[model samples]
Target: MKLRFGTGAILLLAGLMLSQPVLTQAQRQRPPEYREIMQAGRMEDPLAKIKAFEEIKQKYPNSVMMNSIDYLLVSAKIETKNSIDEVVKLQKDILAKSTGPGLITDYLTVNDQILRHKKADSFNKQKLVETIKKNAATGKKNANDAKILDSVPQQYRKRYLALSSTFDIQLATAYILAKNSVQAGRYLATFAKEGGTKDGEYFFRLGQVAELNGQKQKAFNNFFRAAGLEYKGADTKAKALYKKLHGNIKGFKEMLEKKLTELPFEPKHFTPKTKWQEKTALVELFTGSECPPCIGADLGFDGLMETFSNKYLIVLEYHLPIPRPDPMMNPATKRRADYYGAQSTPTTLFDGVNKLGGGGGKGNAESKYNEYAAEVERIIEKAPQVKLNVTAKLANDVVTATWSANKKLPNTEYHFVLVQKQEKYSGGNGLKLHKMVVRDFTTLDTPMKKTVLFNLSQSEKAAEKYLHDFEDQRGFKFDTIHNKIDRAHLKVVFFTQNKNTKEVLNAVICDVKK
Candidate 1:
């Protein structure tokens, strides 16, 4: 329960097994052990699943299920709330016998594990250098291969490489920790060139590396870029660094003012132009915890929610690996992000048509609130077509949830999404307590307006697993969730989308009380 950073989370494999051959009735039924293993394969209580995997392994170490069960065990071990040394030993044992994607991914994670608990010994430094080299070589090969990845399967397209800063930042840190200044300088320079001028953190870090390497010109340029971004801390850091490196900082600040006018992102035209003004609006907020620019963007969105949510709005925050790994990273969220062409953190997709990128304008927080407030006011000016209501009740291990639509929708698809209102996991930027997180979702394709029932078992963990690519960074684990959900902050969101256009029509929220 005390797992910090990326602990106590494992990959859910239920959906992944679907890509293989179809299972017969008997094969599907299998045995009690298979059923038990599948039940514990989610994120609610990883310790329980870890124990289940251990039981299965002890009884049937040589069973035909060893390959599949071994994977589950490895993933569960990563998520187990145990000591770090114990984790290192277990990972080393798995690495000795594992093969294919599992082995490679485990190796990458294990390398980080070693780094996480590294000592001052020269031997530890050598091990870290070796691991860093291995992760880079393997990651590069996998990045270039056109085939489907066997380990992590997040996006089908090559768009994932766009978020390379996730690993690049960690790699550069490892080199710096090892005191390999030459390698650190080289990798950071390449990161700056390939990452371009989009991410402020990348530019800021590049400036630090450049300054350390005595590349004042490169450092000044990168620092100036960071100063133009929305984050005040990064802005201040860039200003201080610029002054340190150059005697006359006043001249640079003056020029930066003019340069920011012609910034990287132009004013995008994302005005809502729906045929019918819908009162109940759904905003798919795609964000990353580590992204500094996201701080302003999130604040702008939250401002709207604080005032407008009571009137008519349902905000669904989808966490993804934009600039870093987030505990709430889900395959479904990533797919939804890709579907909407969400390339960067703090990308807000409103009602599936109005897509806005970047944080709010560079100004005070109050001004930032006004920046997105107008958009929300426009969305809720009129009532929606369907008035959806949803509710959930728990009894023992069973969760009985029901949803109803106010109007008939023969052509629209209804999706019932169960969400965790808030969590205690603070991401890279110290933004803990993530809200409106998608725990699990169900869909009814092309359905008419009617009351529907959905049942969930707390013991079943595989019902909501979505595959995603993590680059060996074992993403936030757990299933769609059954019963281990924090009852206090649990809510259900109802969304109705057009079957043909795929545009979300309307949405409603119902907070559940246990």
Candidate 2:
């Protein structure tokens, strides 16, 4: 998934999560020269910034901030629309000079950019292919070098390992572009041996390579695997190939689903407990219907709901028309997204505080489920500061939700939301069913009474206006617009959270009674 920040600091190096290294006291206090060099990079004029960065490099030939300066200089040049060849050369030069942690970062950045540039018509394909081949050899060595791995922070070592495997896939892709399927297959084999990649694109490419090698069965299997992972066009290709091979696609989906289960990763299954000791945890997910990367997160959320009961875990999902318009998005969902400062899809907050972002393709659903399950399990162990109970009744096209907390602490807010049990929509993403989708909500800083009435028609009307305003702001119309709610499939969710800390003390979810 694409990682963007609003109120939190997080980084994703090609889908591998890496936390920022905590700065040491001495490193936090940088030299005056370092500040000046960084200031030069912040110049408004791109040309001037490039010049300043170049001059600073010359002035401080041995400065510890050389890597930072080099990155800024290259970024400034790119901002000026410099030729891709020139950018590659500059990045390669930096890679040649870098060592330790800088070497790994520069290596990954250089290879990744080169891989992307090779796709464009502007690049010198032959030379670029050679460049990647040479870098791949050296990068593999450096990645395994004890000194280089030691230089990276403990938290980032796994990310480095993941990057090395992804680089091998990039190299294989370059060879395939050069029409050298034999060499591509070799590198692809290495990638497979190294636990494979989370990216569906490479798997699709690998399937193409298998086809070129006349491995028909291998190609069919890989293509089906790619489709199951949510790679675009793979599904069509897989179905056509299945018909060609088996004379018909009688059990294509069933076979593919079975094959996906054979993967090394499996969704975590939790045993249901008959007793409770602490407050139930709430998992609020902010996602987009058109987001392809959110497939894994969406599936993971479904897995969690099936694995745990509402008595122990309450899950809420909010949709947004991010990157593209989503019919499921409502005004209340947008407000919750803005309140959390969520700028990316597939962002999950556990108990209103612990935020985890970034997701992969459908093939990664199980692993993502395990990742989320671990965090929710950790939060479930904590004691609740305040107990909460909620009940709802539907009458006369209106829903009355009454919630009460054992004690209301200062600066605490209570949120009441109406959620649809499930909605079926064919979005850009392949997900056919969305569960626990938030329809509308209301909040109180301090409630004189515990009962809140929600007018279903009014909420739908507000959502319709929100969708219209959304289209106006984007200067285009959505493919489809839906603002109606399934009243019969509605549920009520309530949670008590600290206004300042954004922490949920307790929560509850129950079906809306008729």
- Per-prediction CA RMSD (Å): 14.6, 8.5
Worst lDDT run of 10 residues, candidate 1, spans 1-10
Off by over 4 Å in 2: 1-133, 140-161, 171-215, 236-244, 248-266, 272-275, 407-410
Residue-level lDDT of model 2, residues 1-514, one tens digit each, is 1111110011112111122255467755665577777588558887898888888888888765555666667756655543556767676565665656555455556665555442344566687678777777777777788887876767557656665676677677778767789988898888878865544666677788988887778888888877766567788788888988999999997877765444324545676343455588899999888997788888888888877778789999999877688988998998999999997898899988888776666756766787788887787777789888889999999999988887868888889999999988878876777889899999975667889888999999999999999889989797777788898899999988888999998889889999
Structure candidate 2, residue pairs in collision: none
Candidate 1 global TM-score: 0.43
* Structural similarity to truth (TM-score) of each candidate: 0.43, 0.69
Write candidate 1's Cα lDDT for 1-514 as tens digits: 0111332122113223423355677765556577666676754676777788888889876654565687667756655524444555576565565333333334444555544442412335655566656655664454444452443345322222432333454466567666666777677666656742235555556666776777777877777776665333555666666787666477766766665533333323333455445467788888877775566566565566666644366788887777776656655576677667787888787777776555522322233455566666577766677776677765564455677766777667787777777766656654545667766666765454344343444212332333223533464543322223565666777788876776677887776656
Residue 436 accuracy (lDDT) in model 1: 76
